[model samples]
Target: MHRLLLPIDALVTLFVLTAVWLGVSSSYDPALSYPVQLGVIVSGGVYLAVAHGLVTWRIAYVFGRLLLLASTAAAAVFILQFAYQDYVEVPAIIERIGSLTTLLPNLNLAWQHPNAEAAFMIGTIPLGVVLIVTSRRWLWRSLWIVCTLVCLYALLLTFSRGAMVGLGATLCIAGLVLSKKLIVRVGAVALLIGGIAAVALTSAGSAWVLSRWDLYRNSLYVAGDYVLTGIGLGDTFPLVYSRYGLLIQVPQLTYPHNLLLSVWMGQGLPGLVIFLLLIITFYLFVRRVLRSQPRRLFHAGWLGVTAILIHGLFDSRQYIEVLWLMGHLFALIGLTAACGRLALWQPEEDVPKVFRRYFPNRLVAATAIAAVIAVILFNQELLAAWHTNQGALAETHAELNPTLRAADREAGFRQAQSLYQQALAINPVWPNANRRMGNLYVKAEDFAQAVPLLEQAYRAEPANIATIKGLALAYMWNGQLEGAAEGFNLLPDPARMAEELLTWGYWRTNEQDQPLLGAYAYETSQLMLPGNVSIPVWQAAADAYRAAGELERARQWYERILAEAPDNTAARQALAELDDA
Candidate 1:
């Protein structure tokens, strides 16, 4: 049972789980909270395994190798993130490393990766690497390659173009590397590449792929601007996407299309240097292993790691459990090699000699484990401070997001106002919070409070249609006719502004171009209430048209009301009264 658990890539699987948890733990969503907790339990198990003299065991070295590989991969990811800071949006490194509460349910869903599902993809990396390493025999190798193909196929489901490209390249490289003969290698590579190209041509050729090229070029140009130093990782992706691909709403967003630039943006030159060095170390280690002992285990691990490195260039699987697991598998391969060289106990030294050979390492591991506990505690304190007032605030604001939409539908002006206040207490300058608050005030006929917040939001974001609309609505509600006109004119389309002005103009000038205003009102009423406009809105609009002397248009609207409710006194009386006028 123990053997079954140990060599079957269980350790790597657990490590990937740890990374996944790290990613998941970053989200504060209630839906992901439970999954985060499970991730925590998994991480704890791995930690426990390390504490229980596992690190010193033969398998312990495997764990260490994986840890080292993971650290290296993380460093690589960080470097790429900084390099393409203009395109890729990286989260806080602390968040990437994860938190204790990462085990909470649905916590990580908030983290939207620009390219792919980071946590899920990262999880696959380690698992893939481990599978490759363990599958060196002919059958196992074939199975492993097939597994990799399947994984990449699954990656397409993520709709991450970068991941797809990277996976394709990695597979191509793998076919070449794993080929037993030159002829087979050449044939396989050609066959696969040609097959893929044919499929791409048949489906859509380069049209789908080329459309996003400008974004990539822009990202490269922006990354080059930073040169030796770049913007922080977390800031880059959002900035790039907002600028280049705002119009294109695809699953693989326009972000730091290149991972190398992302890391450069975050940690700058030193980070880049560290990242490059880590990659070099992996290459050197692989070279050394292949030269000294070209075992199948080593070969598989090396190729797997290479694939991840290739993939990391354009995609970030840092948050994925499988990626981390694969990294650990490579580490395990290296560790097994290292331990074979150390030859600490010769399998004959019993448990005491085993203790003698590995006790010092165990002591250090124990000490480090204790320090980690202290750090966790310290982090918990910091998190508490950050959320001291924030938790209540989040709750307040959280209620508003969904509630405002409902309020808008029902025209529940008062309820909307309360929700906006609740949201403001949580986050005063929250964009939607301010907008919704103003809208609510407009609905309640409270123009005074509505104007200031609406203006604030509009100034901050002039292109925001909702803000402009709210501001104009407030002016209209307050009887500030000219102010309403000015506000309406600010809209990009004059025709829309003219139509709006016609309605309010009718209310102001009782007989000025009444026909035009009435026509506009009738058209608007038709659009707003396809079936009928019996609501107060139609009544007011009709009155505005009548005041503007648009007799025909007013008659049309009044006739509409009477059509809906034949015996409705107001409609009948209004129609008769219009005739008298």
Candidate 2:
């Protein structure tokens, strides 16, 4: 049991350290809340603990066999769903092509992302390979073969282009490692080349492949810019990409897509080095174990890890379920290798007498007690913040329902407000609680109450667009025209400014502020809605200028509208009225 726990201890220590560093250094992304991060940590801990227990109790072999059976059954279900969707639900080839434009349908498998499902299936390929190689019975071999084929088919259905590349590369490498004959190696190479060619030659495949290439090139540029201290963990790629990714016309992305680059960009050079070192150490240990033990299961797990790592080269999977699964497999392999080692008791005689005299059990006990107390103190605030976020999400869902009854909607808002207050009572400056509460008030059209809450949120996350928009609107509705305009000016894009102006334009009651708002709106419109302004937008702009007694500017806009639509009665009347003025 001690030998089994050794590898897990090392792994847990490393993971805990990494998690701690990330939590401390990561830039706070509202999308990646503290509750989510805490949940991931808890889940990973549970997985590791369970995996360690299975290995220590010598039940890992049975567990692995059962897992393979379950996975194969799931793969069959996935394949049937795919076939049903493709053949019966939407048979047309053109419709399938259209579906690929969005997300590739998951066939009702609970894995939300197709790429994640594909990665899991691809990782299973090595297990099938190991079973086929090790099983002496014909029935077992045939079952493994069927499982492998099904997984391969399911992988293709996922349409995860990067996973496809990784799978091909992994299979080719496995073939070379497992096959001793030169002829077999040659066949493996040929199959790899042929498969890649087949995929790349297809029109959709070509587009997918080329787009990744563009993204990869852009990622290199990002890596170069932050080659030293990185942008910090959990920092959205858009934070840097907005400035650097324009050349590639890269859409808004959450991550770098490449696992290694993601680490480099998030945690800096030191963190990247540490991550690579961990991988290298694990690989070396696996290789050493395989040499001594020559176990088929160990070989399979090593191959699976290799495949996932290859996949990670082209896609980010570090924070997902794949990583946890990989960690479990690594622990099992490590435990198998360490099983021959003697327990720590056997080494006690070799310890120095002076060191042996001082037992650290008391110190350990005191440390444990302190840690428990700290956690108990911290958990109260964390729970409050988590509940507050949940309430906010509930409110958002209620607000989204256009057909919701007034009573139910009000109840949701009230519940959300209560939750936010609870969170504030625990931690007054809790990150998003104030902002969410403020937005709730804004939705209710209670601008006076919203202004102070929004101001607090704005102070907390000054760069957040939602906070800026909410505060600006709150100010506008509360009759603070100058403050609203100032908040609108904080936006980076002219188009966004124009759009927001249109949203809150009706609130401009101040005569003094009308000409300023009108002039800014019209100027931004020229850049945004070139060639022809929509009638409503033009009329709104004309009305603002007219309210400000700026007939000349209003007349010019009216003339422009008339140019687009010569028969426009409103524009003609407005121009005539301006002329009379």
Candidate 3:
């Protein structure tokens, strides 16, 4: 049989596949090679519709409106989630909406991060703006206006400096290209310059700008080292950045902010080229079509796409933190690629005869098969993440999240345990899953199960405080005094765990009065506390050593404490007792 797609489609498909191949090969965790996969699925489906002339204007219109409505709802949710504030200076209305927003679960409905949400708002708000201008019904127009206003407010509230640049670009492009007046065109240029200046001069702007510079510099450095094959995707970039580059302390500053650089980081240079070629080919195709067959849909796409492009220059994290935003961006790309058909023909334009005969059926079958293969390949990691997330949500209400699951607490706990077991079975070395599952067993006082998982996590991230603390606690409870001592020694600071460690130390001390493990905990606490030896930790250390028959070590500590505090009765008494011994 003849091939299904046209030459253009075949070329685009080839580029996409090539990019995917490069992305997967170079990535540390290819399962999160998000850009290529999402693009293929979304763009391919939209292309099939367009190439077959299956997309009706009415269908396109409905989809656009639904997208606008969803953006409005999501914006509303983001606005109402005031408590988190992401440590940003939010509007005063945030305080008032706390009770209202608390009604919803924190189940990924805007965890209050603005990086992806800001870009999404930039992309989706244009649809509402278009509908507001085009809708004939007053009711529909009014609703669209409300949606646009809400999205605009939410966009500003995100305080994403990149988003502001994108908005400025959107407005300037619309004024210059869409308007007839020369005055408007000139004003657009002036407005853009002013917006840039404002963003650059905004309070705290200089700090972030400098931070971006650091990121860019380090990204370039890293890119040079792994020029042919990148460090990889997912947590790989962060890991590399921390180890080899100028790593900043900001959370989820995972990907390089620029889209091209991010692709290069994950997929190397070849993948970046392919990705650009694929996008350039399609968008240019849309541009050429619109010159002959102009329509509202194309204009709407231009406004949204312009925002993505301009914002992407300054900030592009299209993966990991927000999968839904990846879909949203790809959908826009697909829609832009396909919109010309709706304008050109009456029901829908007739596609080339070759594709018309076997277009969707053959394509869908091929895609399904590929997807099945991919699922099988990625199932272990994918399924493990899914189960681990559910297990975490069930075991404890998420950190900084007030909402808890509505199920019975005991049931939730048991379910968490079961889910974690399944996840670890599938991905035995997944650090987070192992840590959480180990914690669940620890909570049940099952020390045997907890030790190995904690040990695995410790091996993966030795510097991680939570992992070390968990491991230390498990060792202490399990009566592995040496293991417990090592963990406590490794802990940078045990100020928070001081009381608990002190109690454990005293309880486990031998008849000779020396703690089998508490000495290290006490010494570490003494080092970390503000007044290094101001607390009673020194006294406790001395007593534990004296009780352990370490007379010389106990005598030294007692003398040091007396050096700091001559009036310290306890140290004086201990020194007297040691001397008597």
Candidate 4:
């Protein structure tokens, strides 16, 4: 039993960590994605209990045990692939099993670096394995502590807000219950560290972690639009895309920053209830273990759990690898307490009445152990169920997309407009959903509908570079020159000024302001893609110059445009018109 448990715990921990990396790395694909998540959750706790048993019995099974468990997991994945033919992701499966690869940037994932999963797994699991193997060695006794600090530092570098919050919460819990002397020392250290971290965070760290907070907030608002009663499970991606649009084209609903909220949105009240119950159960179990056991190890577990739970508040990996490991830790404590109680010296009179009456005559410990093992063994089914739930959601969106496309085909403008509205019904951040919706209205020469939607999207995502550009276009479509200029100011990068100026000039058609447009255009063209695009700005300036009867300036501007874009139809025509005039 001890041998069985140790490896299970290690694998569970690894699985939990790996799942988070996977989710952050990929899109929200129910057919293939969420099982890896569910596996971590279901197995993390059970295997953790087993690891605790190994630690208690001083077993030596970390390597072979972990290998066996990994094999089991790989086999399960293979079986799942065979079972759900449609959902099987061959490349993903190969990659997942292949371990860490190189760092690669994925716009969909919050962490910009590639092979983040490999880094986290390599950094974290060996600590557990080492702790388990060297349990009896005095030198290795402090291994867990050392590994934890290392993991914490590594986690910090990941700049994952969820991880940071979770780790912080865990430390706070440890500090709260620490013995008086230790508490004082820890408190002082904490204060100093906190002060420094705060200054750094305010200055630099915030850039590392919350670079995407605004995007997260947008997902929340968008989720409410489509998920009236929840969009059903696995519906986040399709719902987000069909409802919101390309601006938010990345699959988000599956792994929102707030993991619990994503579950609530996907699975509704039942999912939320299940999720809450799981947390409460783990908390109760861990609290019981801490109060009853009173060991320094238990205290360490408390800190780890606290960090995870607290961090969970800000960044959710509820169904991911982290939570799974947390579950294992909770189970290990519970198992340790149970095993310790089995050897308790019970006085005849002091024997708890409850134990005599309700506790079993036989070793209930074995039964409990078996139950935990069964949970680990049967975890595959739970993963399969989670995948099914995800699929239902994808189908819901698949069903909606065709209808949206059909509506679009009849009239591009009307389709874009209506699709935007329907998308907002599911995801408020359907990217330029509202922008296109408004633009469609503009194209149809219906400024009224276009204005409000564009305004709403702009306000919801004020920092989004694209949304501001879209709003400016909406204003241009409505011939609102002043409004376009105001919208343009919202952009963070002045480099976008060329596009903004073009929209602005189109709106006002005022030759005098062409210099304003020309200046911005020249600045943008000098720095950006296809540098020749700036030549048009000169041509527009020439048109304006001609209108103002500044013949020499107009000629110069026209000559510049012709020099860059020799086939410049507009510039050539303008020059001819100028010569004729």
Worst lDDT window (10 residues) for model 1? 242-251
How do all the candidates rank in terms of TM-score, highest first? 2, 3, 4, 1
Residue 454 miss distance in model 2 (angstroms): 26
Q: List model 2 lDDT by residue over 335-430, tens digit each.
A: 333332211224445433322223333544676798688669887655665666556445643553346688988887788788888887887876
Q: For candidate 3, lDDT tens digit of each residue in 438-491?
A: 766766779788999989977876755556777776776675756765676665
Candidate 2 local Cα displacement, residue 13, angstroms: 2.5
**Worst 10-residue lDDT window, candidate 3:** 396-405
In Å, residue 163's CA in model 2 sits off its true spot by: 2.2
What lDDT, from 0 to 1, does candidate 1 have? 0.46
The Cα local distance difference test for each model comes to 0.46, 0.60, 0.65, 0.46
Steric collisions counted per model: 70, 0, 4, 25
lDDT of 4: 0.46
Misplaced by over 4 Å in model 2 are: 1-12, 24-61, 76-112, 187-202, 210-273, 286-293, 316-551
TM-score of each: 0.37, 0.56, 0.55, 0.51
Residues forming the 10-long window of minimal summed lDDT in candidate 2: 336-345
Question: By how many angstroms RMSD does model 2 differ from the true structure?
Answer: 11.8
